[model samples]
Target: MKPTIIRPQGLPDSVSSPVVTPIMPSVVYASDTPDALDAQYEGRTSGYTYAREGHPNADVLARRIDALEGATGGIVTGSGMAAVTAALLGLCKAGDHVLGGDQLYGRSLRMMRDDLPRLGIETTLADPTDAASMEAALRETTRLVLIEVVSNPTLRLADLDGIAALCKARDILLVVDNTFTTPRAIKPFEQGADVVLHSVTKLLAGHSDVTLGWVAAKDPDLQRQLYDFIVTTGLTPSPFDCWLAERGLVSFDLRFDRAQRTAETLGRWLAGQAGVTRVLYPTRDDHPDRARAQALLRGTGGNMLSFEIEGGRAAANAFAAAAEGVAFAPTLGDVGTTLSHPASSSHRGLTPEARAAIGISEGFFRVSVGLEDPEALQDTFGAGLAAARGAR
Candidate 1:
């Protein structure tokens, strides 16, 4: 029997619509016209005359992400940092000020602290968990308020609705990094965020094979502005990378669901174990923002969890070295569980004082759970804990 090719309706068999499939080279120039060629040759218009500006695959991924986030539209970028930089630069000008959350991604912290200020854009970091503190930090020149739906190493959940309301009242754009809580788990736009960003390298892609980023916004104008900046600045994702991301999205729901369940089980098990000083999972009872997290996040608390060891840096390093089955790596949101020592890896650029300010202690370890059996994962940690404690 000849193979039957099943293509998504309204999309060519070569390309996935809702999710992009690989396209054949033969189809690349199928739609090119003499007029289009002339326009490209003449550098005529702002429309997609080249893939650098826009491509069908990237556009589809953007639309799918926008639908998932319940936003007007979205733009895909080459990397998470590109998405963040594009969003921040597109929204604010030289004289503008940005009010950002305290527990941001380390690279984002660097951008805000080092780069933006050099360009005359000032920033103030606030603890979004403390609404009073966030309010107090806002200034008259503030043009944007940025927060992560869930922070990188700490797993701290920001008050999205509260921050959105604050930004709305102050006429500032509310930019949220929704990397930890992918659209499968939470939609920040639905919760009142003006713009939602994602490190598609993480949960959104799920496979850890691609590096892509996205920004979803409620206002069409805002979306257009961001898209324009991204294209003009040449920070857009390649067609191939966009296709990989789209394929990843097809399995995002199932992957995240399984990972979240494993995370919850591990979080509870770790909380009960000896030599574990603290477990910071959003669903845990002792979490400071548990109530707010429950109120805002729709599905599971997510796969990322952070814990501090009883014996500080030495113990943490020992546990990380002794851990079996899971990979002790810097990046997160992969099919295989990976661990990060933020004080040294992600947040290394920050001063010791800055790291301490965000509760990222020397003993802390951030775990990104994967789709592995809960019992196997638990036993691995149990052995690692024993080894770590013995070393002390």
Candidate 2:
């Protein structure tokens, strides 16, 4: 059911309608009879009986995200990590095996490598930059193949369609982390992904305030199972957070479009700037996976780019400290430009060898371009470059 759209006061009751939905933080809903409440509990009825099981606010946000992904259903979790944990547990048993990309978010990699093992699931990691690495990692016991659509920090593109086709032939589920590329940028379901997950704290939420994660799937059984897991594990988000996320969706498209444009501008600018060794944005011709990125991604390669500052970590720190208008947050996808050092932040948990394998060197820094003016970004980065080149 659609949320009621209220008309504003004194506008002839026709010209204005509320563009936002009200927050529903109630933990329980009324039921006429025990039978009705039982039916709701058993998923036979439509109303929400309990917040942990299901909340009206979360349901609205889930439906919104699923609609964006062209999915059958979606669920909002307490965090993106919760979404991953719930989805994986919902799909696999104790003995099930899984495969994934080598370059993943540190926490996710740990979950697949450390936590899942303690829970009796096995996982193998390999470079997902090409189909060969993915093919080599597959096992007879593999139940799911997980990959990042674009790798963290490095911004490398995965052969999404290629891996998806392989998973189909093997009858294994394919899951893609769509955080870097939101549904507005790419629909993984259309590319053969069985499931898509996002840390809505990033692009979907737009602002840097809320912490949310969501999972979307085009399969009825998987969706039901995921919902059950969320409810049982108490990973569902609070109504207030879900409500704020729903509001964020109101301007998601515009934010994504502007961010993508700004990223492209910065990618090009960084490529020619002094003290910049290389840019790893997927849209660049020099990128090894540019062709694959073109085949899989829509619009530009997204609003993320990782560059090698000529002067190493010290220079990277100088750049961030010297840039006037930019903020150096440990996170990304905010409306304002932010910088992060993967070696110290996002990929800090990985070993030196592991980080090197993913193209994260001592000088590497990832920049998330925001909706700020292109010229302003140029000047900010220019100061950063001056620091790196020892001119400042």
Candidate 3:
């Protein structure tokens, strides 16, 4: 006998129940009925009264993300920064403090350093890999402990479970940025994180086409608060973008798996190269947090890897220009591999001292391996390394 197939009720033949509706209907609201007016005007109802506040497509994506992250619920935003900003603002009060990992996305760092302070939310940066430092940094006024599963430029793995245990004892909300790992590799909530955030533009989307963000939380109250903030602040995603993200998520597992394999291969090759000084990838035995990464990550290391060149900025730029198969660009997790210099592209906004403090060297380069042939990518980097050496 064929295996039984269970389908969700009211779903069409082609689309899954968790997928967005193909056709959006136009409804005319009658102002005469008091009940209808109350349902439409009052935001208490759990329906999409307005597209900006909520939409069927957005809800579908949010539900899918929540399920993937194993969270009670989730909210989709226009951009990754929107997700980060809303998550922080929703959970933190005016006088509350936030402890963040030192190696956060450059834009996120700017938001914490410049924007949040203006709103009376103070933040302190700590090395996420160091549990003792994070524990010591936490204060009585700390409402949230923010950590990225993998640091951006350095590709260092954070000790999520250790940090979570620390935060749990202090009654602090543990917010994890799982953009680098994606849901296919690791679910932060299952690892003791209270909330998980993602920049869907990266590996989650799999193709660098659409920009979206998500916040998944275990607490129903926290999810509700995040949804309220998203709706009220008009930071919701567009229907078309939501649809694109949904399509991207369908093949996420395959893309992430292939890309991660390629990344690991490239990372190992780079580590053995003469011009490359330091290679940062969690799966590598030389990685400082290799054991911690093995404990936290479920699948391959991830698609992102970074290395420092021996000759610094000029050599790095020359190497990037000589790269063939991998495009010399800042954006990551694309169908085609892309590269960027952290000191210039993503972390350029930081002051010299600040950049140095974060360990973003002038010669450092970050590579986002894509769904390309592993050999082709390795050759491309090999050529780039040769060019860097020649330049030196």
2-62 per-residue lDDT for model 3 (tens digits): 7765632343475436344553432222244568658766755545456776777777888
Q: Which tens-of-lDDT digit does each residue in 1-392 have in candidate 1?
A: 98865642244465435332554222223225788777764668433456666777887788878778887668889999899998899888998999888878888988888899999999999887777789999899999988988887887778777788888888888898988888877878777788889889997888889999988678888888897888789996877778888888888889988999999999999999988888999888899888888887864689999998877778887888888778988998898899889988998877888788888788889999999999999999998899889877
Candidate number of the best lDDT: 2
Candidate 1 deviation (Cα RMSD): 5.7
Q: What order do candidates take by lDDT, descending? A: 2, 1, 3
Model 2 lDDT vs. the true structure?
0.85
Q: Supply every candidate's count of residue pairs whose N, Cα or C atoms clash at under 3 angstroms.
A: 1, 0, 0
The residue-level lDDT of candidate 1 at 113 comes to 88
Q: TM-scores of all models?
A: 0.89, 0.92, 0.90
**All models, RMSD in angstroms:** 5.7, 5.5, 7.1
Global lDDT scores for all candidate models: 0.83, 0.85, 0.83
- lDDT (0-100) at residue 143 of candidate 1? 91
Candidate 3 whole-model C-alpha lDDT, 0 to 1: 0.83
Give residue 29's lDDT in candidate 2 (0 to 100): 69
TM for candidate 1 is: 0.89
All candidates in order of TM-score, best leading? 2, 3, 1
**Candidate with more favorable, higher TM-score: 1 or 2:** 2
